[model samples]
Each structure stands twice: as structure tokens, then as C-alpha cells.
Target: MTSYFNDVAVWQPHDLAYFKRLKAYGSRGVVVKSSQGGYGGTPYINSVGKLQVINAKRAGLKVALYHYGTFNSLRYGQADPASEAKLMANTAKAWGLGKDTLMVLDAEDSSLRTKASADAALFFNELKRQGFHSFDIYGPGSWFWAGRLKIGTSYKLGGWPASYGSSSSGVSGAKAWQYTDNWKGLGVDGSLDYGGQYTTKSAEPEQKPEPKLTKQNVDDYYYTYNPKRVIVKRTIYQHKNNQLGSQANRGRKLKPGTAIDIASVHFSSDKVPVPYFKLANGTYITANRWFVNNAYYELSNLKTIKVIKPTYLYRDLHRTKVVKRSGFKSNKWPKGTLFDVKKVIHWQGGFVLKLTNGFYCTAYKKYVKKIK
Candidate 1:
């Protein structure tokens, strides 16, 4: 089963009954905010911080601590890093917290030379040097996405940054989520932890690493995660980049009947990155433009057929309306050009072949035949 931890601050008081209720509701962890700035240029535990831990432990919950982060640059006067670390260390000791108890840095202010990640690295490095283990960083969703904080992999737990009353778009790279405040009438922030991210009654068990898919190992990713694929319409050019300007420089027109795996799809976006699918060989097609101009064949299947003679391509499934029939018949293809047809469907009196490009053509056996 899964477990959860709620990061509580001074604003939230210690209620033993509430703690017991949370335990009854399957919460096994509580992360109390233990420090703030201005305690002799160092931060100390919050007013009810230690007491909250005691109450949570009494109510049978594992307790961790987080601190409101501030750096030397943000301080108006003398900022002593060593003294601040000493004070926090003393508070951590006073509360009997350690690696198993998880210390988190809550950094919202981007005051480190306007570089949140850099400042985070600086502050977290100091904490590490001071012999603190099991660190974490908490901030808004954008803070993690814009990647301002250089939060190395050493930190395990990640808390969601969504505040009260705002909808969370998504949680990217976050193992744990702080989805909302005012959770279920308790007025405490609610969270969801994935895997064994939040601890249970036992120590963390060892885990195996999951394999990643890169260009070098795309075959593995494709074969492992293959889903329903798509068939191309008449024709669409695959571009190196989905952006229009870049497409001009790097567009390679692909024929109909080519299958492409869905890389990603979005109904709308500011930037439509990864609109199409990548080929099994790791080639990619951009879906930014063309809607894209691809369509599916019968059962989304593609089969190759050789043109033994010239054939007139039709504009629609009824082959009588030949493409450019009156004006030089530009759509006609010579014998050498092979057509990848989904099937030669029986249409009208004469048969019309269903092309992968979502068009139809005459399927006279003498003129064309399916190849093995």
C-alpha cells in the first residue's frame, strides 16, 4: 500500500485528534516546517514545530522537518552561514531528526541573484557540508520545470508546490505532490506520494533502476511500449523541427502508407512539441502543421502493390472521378512506382484499391498485383 506526508507550518497548529484522524485516513508521515529567518541571522524551528513532531509521533506517524530557505544575499546585513547551520543543526538534534526524518528546503523567493537554482545549490551544499543528509526541495510547479534549482539527485523526496484553491496543471519530475491546502476541512495541505517516496513504518527498501529510452536504445523503448499506430494520408512531409521556418530547411516528404508511432499528441499548446510519432529506427516527424495531412487505411494496415502498368489515381473512393482526368492526368503513376495500398476493395462494378494515403485507384489485376 501507499503512504502520504503533509508539510505543515506555524500557521497550522498541532491537534492530536486531527493527527489521529489523519492516521486513520492512511497518512503515515508529517513534514513540519521547523525554521524561519531572524533567529540571530540563523533560522530555528517554528513555534509549534517540535511539539507537532511529538504529537505526530504520539499519534503513530513518522515525522520529518522542512525549513523556510533564505540565503546570505537575501539578508540586508551580515549573513553568517556557519551560525545559521549551527542553529538548524541544534534544532534538528533537539527534535531528534536525521536522514530517516527528511530535511527539506522550501525555496520560493528567487533572491539569489535572481537565480533560484544557483542559490538553492549554494544553500543545500552548505547544509550537506554541515553533515545533514536526506534533503528535499519544495517549490511551485514552474520552479521545477524552468529548472532554476540545481537540486542534485542526492535528495529523494519532492513535494508538490500547488497552493490553496489553484488547479494543478501537472506534476513533472516530482515523486511527491502537495496538490492543495485546506484538505478535507482540516486546513492542512494535502499531498500524494508515489512508489515508496514517503516512508512507511519501516526503513526504505532497496530499489532497482528503470531503463530509459534514448536514440541509441529506441528499439527497446518501441518494442516494449508499442501501442496502436497510425497510417499516413495522401502524403505529408516529416520535418526536423515542427516550427515552420525550420521545416522549410529540413522537410522530407514521406509517401502514404508509412506507419509512425505516436510520440505525443496535444489538442492545444503554446508550443506543439512532439506532435507526431517516431519511427522504430528513431526517426521523428513533427505534427505542428498539417493537422497533419495523414489518414488511415482499412484497419490501419498498409500493404505494398507493384504497378505493372500506368494507373490513373482517383480523387475519391469512386474511381470514375480520376484525379486530373481532363487536364493531362498529373496523378497517373508509371509502372515502376509502387503503391502501398491497404487493400483492393470491391467498389462499384470495377474494383477500387484503397491506398494508404486515403485515396482510391483502379485495381485491375493485369495492371497491378500485391507483392509478397
Candidate 2:
């Protein structure tokens, strides 16, 4: 099971450190895809080239060069067929990579479904015909051979990281797998790369013992004690702290549908910088960013509530109100009486809930209802 790290044009500044660490973790090979510069010249191969040089300087390192068939159509038109071949040829020559280095064609854009497939097939076949033994193919699981083009044995697979558990089963004759499109440990500015036999290990264990918490639990609290719980769903991205706004704190993005066990919740007068939860395995991570009501629920019960209302703030002190209503509200409750939470707003010491109907109210801890 050979693993290939395939991020060429999307390389972030900190990818160098990530590559080094990946190698330390037992990766056998690294492949970089080249991207065009901000000013738009031949995609700058300098960073990737330098990394290759550095890896070559080290012992027992394998590095490959890859180029995307086409960048975002919005930014760069479908990669010119002639230009694509030239990019591969030039990068190989510049990096002094011989037949030992792998050359990959990552083709996953829906816009170039047919054209890109043909181009990639031609490019890789040409490389193989010229005696390039390590040539490969890559793309998101969905887009690979979308046009039904026959992928010759000369090419291998470079799948997106998120597609691992789901689509990896369908991949055949793939010499390498590009498991993740992003790695947050590299920071928002950096991306983690994985390849070689090291990537075959499961990065993290699945969350177990699902929580039975439901909308009834939330509504029971509102009616019995007037407090409500908010539920937020977070997806993991490759860059852990990439979307975080404040420099003072860091967080992790959850895999699109990965379940997490929420340990605890906290509220503050100021915005809470989401904390990054390190996984037992150094590879995967979790972040506690979503805040509901005033309490933070652990990943255990958190997964039960899919729809959460935002926290709303109210200035009027006289009227006692119930802010945001959860979607899991009791189906037995009257329609107008149930208020949905839309957004979360900070107030006093903790946070306030914004009801779906546009009302604001405060939830006291005593009002929390826990229903099995």
C-alpha cells in the first residue's frame, strides 16, 4: 500500500515543516503540485523544487513532482494542453528528478470533465512511453474518470483525504493515495501532506456510545426551567486553524461528517477562541468552537441535536422571554409558543439565545433538562 502526498499548486507557506514532520511519521514519498503565481507566470516551481532538493539532501527520502491539469476555471482557464505537458517536463528537468521520481496528473475538476481526462491520459501515457516508470493520476473520488475515460495502468490514484473511509474501497491499481486535501496542524497558512506506506494506518478511532439527547430534552428545559441548549455541527478541514479569526487561539475543523465527543462547554463576555483538541494519534484533531445556550455539550450528546438556534440578546429587562428554539422542539408543543434559536449573542457574564421568531431571552442553568 503505497501512499502519495499530492498538493502541488495549493502549497501553503508552512508545508515544508509539514512535509518534514510527515516524513518523520514514516511517509515514504511526497509529491507536490505546482500552481501559478499571483502575477501569473509558469506556476512557481521554486518552493516544491527546493523541498525536493532538501529531501534529496536527507537520507531515505522519496519526492515526486505533480501539476494540476487545470486550476479553478475562475482563476485560470482549463490548463492548456500544451502548457500542461510543458509544465511537467520543465518541473522534472529543473528538479533534476530522473525516472525514480514520480510524475502525477491530478484531474478532478467537473468543468474539465471530458477535456481534462483526455489530456491527463495523453500526458501520463506520453510519460510512460518515454520510460517514466513512476507516473500516476489523481483527483477527488467523485471526478476521477467522471467522463468514463479508460485510465491506463501507467497511472495511479491520488484521492482526496476526506474520501478515505468512503471511496478508498473503489480505487484500483492505485499506487498511491492522497488521503487529505488539507492538514490543519500546518496552521491556516500551512497544509499537511501524507504518502508512502505510513498513511495506511487509521488516523483516529471513531466516536462510540452515541448520545440519546433529543429536542425534547432542550424543550423540557425551556418549559420547566426556561433554559435551552444550542447544538452546532462542525466539519473538519485539512487546515486546523485556517478559519480561526483570532491569533491568540487555535481550533480544528472536523471531518465533514465525523462525530466528536463534546467534553465540556464554556462561555465568556468576550469571544472564546476555539481550542484545538489533539487526538490520541497525532494525525487527526478536534476543535471545541460551537457554543449553545450557556453550556458546552460533549461530543457524546452533541451529535444528537442536529438543528440549533442562535443566541439572541434583548435590551428590555422587564419582559421575560425565551430566545431561540431548537429544531428538535417537542412536536407536541403549540406552534406560536415554540421559539427557535437562530444566532448566539454575548451578554452579561455568559451568552444569550436568539429565538427563531426574533425574540431574545436568557437561560438559567437550573432550567437545563436532561432527558435520556
Candidate 3:
């Protein structure tokens, strides 16, 4: 009788209840795909990896993570393996994986076969340098048999090779042998654990101490939240505090150019001069100067503006040239003439409103009455 553990990638079904059922069916542990090749110069993190890890733990299964290696591909091979390893390690740490978690490198790509050992050595070495110790390399048994990926003698890392049809994995010194693609009709890859990483439990990483809170300095701000409306200018995460670190939650992606209503601003002593915005929904987002624009927030809030007093339209913010023939019957907008506000620009000591016709006018309450 062969004891088997399950391993999954994006292709596998990830229902939490299903994992509970796998545990009930006598499976002891599982390996989950955590990342892939670098995307846009960073590791391509699996969207469901965190969810899978959580569910597996809830199901009482001893769990670990693996990265689908592509550093050997023609497109990504030019990159240093250390960079990819660091990105992967950082991502895993961000996901709350423990330092002792078994991190496996799935180096099955034929393009990697020739240099698998050297590159895997470098990749695992960087992971080790980053405080991750337990590691393994998984691939076809023939790759090891042909001397394509000899495990480094200096490192405690082991191999996990797949050799389906046989009772034993042909590769010598393999930590585990993947024996079947479908175990007990579960429709997932099954590996026979050899009493190593797959069976050993990993401890969670230590949590950092929370930082002290303080009122945001006025000098640290460029644009103040006037109407409680904010617009995201760059993708950012929601954090529990103003201090930025791995604790920033990546589950919710505050995308660029998104206009959102904020409840208020939170001040913190994060060493960096940025304040945090408390959203209407009670989530905290960084008010990083480079990541948000309050100008758009003001613009989107003003649906229309009414002329409370006579005003002349200027071609630009300079307010120097007011044409004699304005679009209306006169050069000035008459009192009570209503128009939609298209843009808002902060000018000297005040804000300016732009009309749909590319004309600018003072946004002062005396000149224009804002209509929500």
C-alpha cells in the first residue's frame, strides 16, 4: 500500500469543501502552486494561491508552496535567477508563508533541462539568503537520471521527480515520488511522501510590532481633502496603518484613476510623510503623494455650477485674455446661467473650474454656485 499526498496548480479545483473532503479521504497534505515567471519585471503571483493556502490549513492539511520556474525560457532566461528567486520569496512572505515552508521549484520546462542544476542552485541559494530554508526541485525523473539537475551537496534541498507507472521514483535521493495524476478518482496529482517536507509541518513567520500613530504633518500634504472625494492615480493596497510594509493587504486592488469617496484622513508616524485615507467603507489606503490626485476628486464631485455673478471666460489659468465675443450673446456669463463643470484646477489661493467648451472661470462661491 502506497501513501500519497496531493499537489495542485491553477488547473486544479480549489473549493475549500473539496479540500476538506480530500483530508477526510485519508490524504495528509498538499502542495500548491504559488507563483510563475516574472510579469512586468515582477513575479507573477497566483491569484488563488493565498486562498488555497488558507483553505488547506482550515482543512487540517499540512501545506507548502511551489513556483513554476521559467528562468530557463528564451524570454526570461536572460534575467538573473537571483532576481526571480527574491521576487518569489518576497511574494511568499507577503502571503504569510512561514520561513520553514517547503518552497518547491517546478523546473519541468524542456528549455530548462540543460541548465536546471546551476540555475536551480542559484534560485534556491537566493531563497536561502532570504531566510527560506526548506526547498525542493520537482521535474521528470529522466532529467535527474541524465545528470541535468544534480542536487547541490552543500544545500539540504532535495528532488521530487515524477515517474508514473512504477512503484518507485527512478531518481536517486528524491524527497518524494509523484506516482499518479488521479488518486482515488480525485482528479489531482498525487505524490508518495518519503517522510520529508510534504509531511513535516511549517511554523508561521513572526509578526512585526505595530508602529506608533501620530497626526499627519500639514507640511507633508500637497492636496488637502476638501470634499472627502479621492481618486487613485496608481495601483495600491489597503493597509491597517500608515506604515507601509508586507502587511499591506493585496486582496483588494485600488486601481489607478479610480474615484472613491473617503470618510476622513488618518495620521500615522510611519517615518514616511504620507497620510492614510479612511475610505467610506472603513478601509485604509495610503495617501501617498505619488499615488493619488485630489484634483480629480474635486472635479468629479461638481456636477454643475451656476453663475451667481457676472464672470468672463478666460482661455487659460493665466486669466489674461478674455475674448470680446463669447459663445453666449455677451462676453460675460450672465447671473443664473447654469453650466456643467468639466474640470477643476487649483490656482493661486483658490480653485478654477473648466467648462465643456475649453473655457476657464473662477470657482469661488461668489462667482459660481456649485450644484451637486
lDDT of model 2, residue 193: 33
The list of candidate 3 runs beyond 4 A from truth reads 1-3, 39-43, 73-79, 202-372
Whole-model Cα lDDT per candidate? 0.59, 0.42, 0.73
Candidate 1 regions with alpha-carbon error over 4 angstroms: 38-44, 72-83, 110-113, 150-159, 163-169, 201-372
Higher-ranked by lDDT: 1 or 2? 1
Candidate 2 per-residue C-alpha lDDT over 1-372 given as tens digits, one digit per residue, 9 for 90 to 100? 344332433334333565566556545445555432212344545554556445533624455566656533233543344455566666676666665556666565554545455565656665565566565555654454353333443464333322444535244443344444443343221212333422232223333343343444423222122122323233433223333335334344443334443332222222422233323333223233332132432212211111233333343433244333369554222322334455444444344444555544544322322231
Q: Write the per-residue lDDT of candidate 1 for residues 1-372, one digit (tens) a residue.
A: 545667787887787987888788767788888776535554556878888888888998877777676655455433443344455666778877664456677777544345565555555566677687666677776666666543345554454454445455255555666776766667787776653445454233223243443555533322222222444433555655434336564556665546555654322232322234555544455442222322222222437778777878876785677666455546677787787887756443235678777767755554665664
TM-score of each: 0.48, 0.40, 0.51
Error of 2 at 178 (Å): 3.0
Off by more than 4 A, model 2 = 1-10, 13-18, 35-48, 56-59, 71-79, 110-115, 125-131, 145-150, 153-169, 182-184, 187-372
- Colliding residue pairs in candidate 1: 34-45, 117-148, 117-149, 160-178, 233-294, 233-295, 233-357
Q: Each candidate: RMSD to true structure?
A: 17.8, 18.9, 22.3
Model 2 quality (TM-score): 0.40
Task: Point to the candidate with the largest TM-score.
Answer: 3
> How well does model 3 score by local distance difference test?
0.73
Per lDDT, what order, best first? 3, 1, 2
